[model samples]
Target: MTVALATSLGDDALILGQRLAEWCGHAPTLEVDLALANIGLDLLGQAQFFLGAAGAAEGQGRDADTLAYRRREDEFRNCLLVEQPNGDFARTIARQFLFSTWQALLFPDLAQSAAPAIAAIAQKAAKEVAYHARFAAEWVVRLGDGTSESHRRMADGLAWCWRFTDELFMDDTAKFRPEWDSHINATLTQAGLATPKPVRGITGGRHGRHTEHLGHILSALQYLQRVYPDATW
Candidate 1:
């Protein structure tokens, strides 16, 4: 169970990192591009730690790179939220806001985990996730209240991203929904945006079932390692 949990969390970070990295040179502005790149690196770092821990737990001697670069798409256990296409800046912000909020809530709990390694990783990751949540929240408010077109785009982004929110609470220990709700609601309210009406969430990613997007992500992410097995700097 510990291995599974670690692998899942690692997959979440790895996939989201890849998504954010896609915006390295393409974000709305130079500052935003750099910020997204840095966030992506943070997530990738978290993924490496979690996957390394998971490899140790599995006792297969696979290590992080082996687990990450060699996995098939169906073997990945990231949530559906992270794999969705980056539709627009607003949509990406909405996705980031929803996910980073949940991560901020989750990492604190994991920081106190009985598993020592997991706890250590969580402690370090919690700080990073907090900043991620703050960054996303700031953008959510900025775009949501900025102007008519931005407002429409932000609202639409929220709605588009809303269906994935419920999956974040599916873990029995993930009981922070109320806190998440309060935080998100306050942000939306302040931004003059409506909280999205709850919808039947698109689930199953945790079980290795994913949207088609994950396949494309994996193809690109694994390409270098796949074509040049074990080639190193």
Candidate 2:
């Protein structure tokens, strides 16, 4: 359970960091571009810590880079939400808003985990994700209550993001749901958007059943390592 838990957390951060890094040079403004880059760096750091802990726990001689770059799609255990494409600014914000809010609630409790390494990672992550949630929420409200086009786009993005949310709470993270919903509801209300009613969401990412996007991500992520065959700088 400890290994699986840490691996999952690491995978989530790694994949989402990659997704955010995609916006590094492409955001609508330079300010947004830098913000996404910094956020991606933060997540990458968290991924390193958690995956390093997992590798240590597994006693397989694998390190963070090995676990991150060597794993196949079926071996990855990240949640489905983080793997979704960054469709538009609104879509990206919706995904971040949803996932960050959950992370904000989750890491506080994770700081209490019995595994001291995991607990320490969670302790530091709690502060980072609080800012992440707030950043995303500010955009959520700005776009959701903005001009007609922005409002429509924000609503559409939220609808796409909403289904994957159920999967976030499906595992041990279920304990955080009440707080998650409360924060989500308040944010949406403030944004002038309706709180989406619960529905049966797509699952299986946690068990290594992933969408097609992950395969593409891995091909790019692992290419250098695979080509070099463990060559290091």
Candidate 3:
């Protein structure tokens, strides 16, 4: 259970980091691009810690790099939300807003975990996730209350991501759900956006049944590692 939990956590950060990295040189503004890139780097750093912990828990030869690059799509345990395409600026912001908000709740709880190493990692990462959540939230409010087009796009983006929000709590601790609800509802209210009606969310990402997007991400992400095993800088 420990190994599986750690792996799922690591995969979430790794895959989302990759998704955020795709915004580099393509964000609506230079500041936004730099911000997103930095956020991506933060997520990658978290991934390293979590994946390393997973390897240690497994008592296997695998390390962070080995687990991250060697795993096939079906072997990964990231949530389907992180694997989704960053469709537009609005969508990217929406995804980050949702994921980082969850991360903010998640890391703090994990900081109290019995595992000392995981607790330490969670303590450090909780700070970073705080900034990520705030950054995305500000954008969500800004875009949502902006001009007509921005408002429409922001609403559309939230609609796309709304379904996945439920799965964040699926098969996990029930403690975070209440806090998550209050935080999300408050943010959406301030943003002048109503919570979209919940739909039946697509699941199975945690169980390694991912959408086709994970394969495309892994192909690019693992290319060099796959080609030259053990080669390093």
Best model number under lDDT: 1
lDDT of 2 at 167: 91
TM-score of each: 0.98, 0.97, 0.97
For residues 91-140, what per-residue lDDT tens digits would candidate 3 score against the true structure? 99999999999999988888987378788888999999999999999999
Model 2: per-residue lDDT, tens digit, 149-186? 99999998999888899899885778888888899889
TM-score, prediction 3: 0.97
lDDT of 1 at 116: 84
| Model 2 lowest lDDT segment of ten | 195-204
Residue-by-residue lDDT tens digits, candidate 1, 11-124: 999999999999999998999999999999999999999999999999988999999999999899899999999999999999999999998988998888638878899999
Error of 3 at 145 (Å): 0.4
Error of 1 at 70 (Å): 0.4
Task: For each candidate in the order shown, give its overall lDDT on alpha carbons.
Answer: 0.93, 0.92, 0.91
The residue ranges of model 3 lying beyond 4 angstroms of the native Cα positions read: none
